[model samples]
Target: MQTVELTVRRTVGRSLVFQTKVLEVDANRDDPTIVVACPEGLDPLEHHFDASIAWTSALGRMEYAVTTRPERRGRGRVWLLTLTGPLTGVQKREYFRADVSIPVVVSWTDGPPAVSASTNGTEPQTHRLAGVVLDLSEGGVLASVSGVPPPVGTQVQSVLRIDDDEIVHAATVVRHVSLAGGTGVALAFADPSLHGDRLRQVAFEAERKRRRGD
Candidate 1:
């Protein structure tokens, strides 16, 4: 265990895991223990009795087993959680994200193939849905859609546009959608290429430059 302070986030959404100040830590001990002020909202001990703590140390980001069965300290909201063992191997992020907003078209087959009377051609009954890409990364795009979001585990073809460049990729809608966030959904890219990566990066940089009055 290292003595350096760590910033931890939930692995899924990269949301802050805690908003409390560290009260005590015994990193030198064989089995370390950490005491932190409980957050104002949810009680960790209620559900997260045993969970993983993702933190970045001097070595890198890593996660370790943590027990939330707190030992109350007097009347204050501070609670102690024991780290059962040493920190596990460092965790490496799979992708870098670029925050931006861009128009995206998601196309998916609704049902069986349909035949066009004018063209006399048979094709999959595809439906096109519009969304705004809230964040772009090599792994996925988090988008805020207009209408009802597709169900989880559904795979769809997406066309992302950054200026004149349009890149198409297959993506899956994640289950953790936020309706309050304008029907937002997380789409994981099945196969991302360098072309799409460059487009997203360039678009993000351009947006940054614009905000700088450049």
Candidate 2:
């Protein structure tokens, strides 16, 4: 079996999955094995094991078979795990990675996302502002706009503005608000990281192309 290096494409919910190139078909040999090494703070599918991870050499792609596992007893969150199977003939490798990067607008009243006495940006930048999703590489998160925004139950919409394009998605507020002052609302993206992921993917592919040119 031939092995190929695969870059980490995307991640979500503490799971990172990259793909390797499928070997060209010449003859049959032992079933190929894959060794997955995720970055810090991520875990591989434990229960499914090989069933949740598989690839096709003849087809030159991979696919994830998954199911949603309800989070907690209250349905506060969810775990979508894929059951890997034999990848016999995979194609149309669009968005090969399952994770998404969404666009968002963040706002603050008491101060910038991060609190500071001045606006010189000397203070740490508040990437995850209430109602704003600054970065998605970390675990998915919620922003509390006002007074911790809404907890348990709140209605929200994610209006993302990217370049000249805009997309909207519905989201539910899931958090625990408090009486403390200065809170921002987090707008959940049904398709979180949609725009962000696309941009990153395009950049990555472009860089690959450039390096190839070089």
Please give the clash total of every predicted structure, in order.
Answer: 0, 20
The residue-by-residue lDDT of candidate 2 on 1-214, one tens digit each, is: 3322233323332233332332233233343333333212223332232224333233334555433222222322222333334444356322222222344644223323554567555443332232433333211233334323434444455555545775455555545433244453434444544454444343333433443352
Q: Report model 2's TM-score to 2 decimal places.
A: 0.31
Q: What is candidate 1's lDDT per residue for 1-214, written digit by digit as tens?
A: 3222222334343322332446778688776777766654545454344455543333444666666545567546555567755777675644434568789988777665687779776676667789998877656788888877777888988888877978788889875467574888788888655354364355445444444445
Best lDDT goes to which candidate?
Answer: 1
Stretches of model 1 off by over 4 angstroms after superposition:
1-93, 113-124, 179-181, 194-196, 203-214
How well does each candidate superpose onto the true structure, as a TM-score? 0.48, 0.31
Residue 83 error, candidate 2, Å: 16
Q: What is the number of residue pairs that collide in model 2?
A: 20
Give the clashing residue pairs of candidate 1, or none.
none
C-alpha RMSD for every candidate: 14.1, 17.7
lDDT to native, each model: 0.62, 0.37
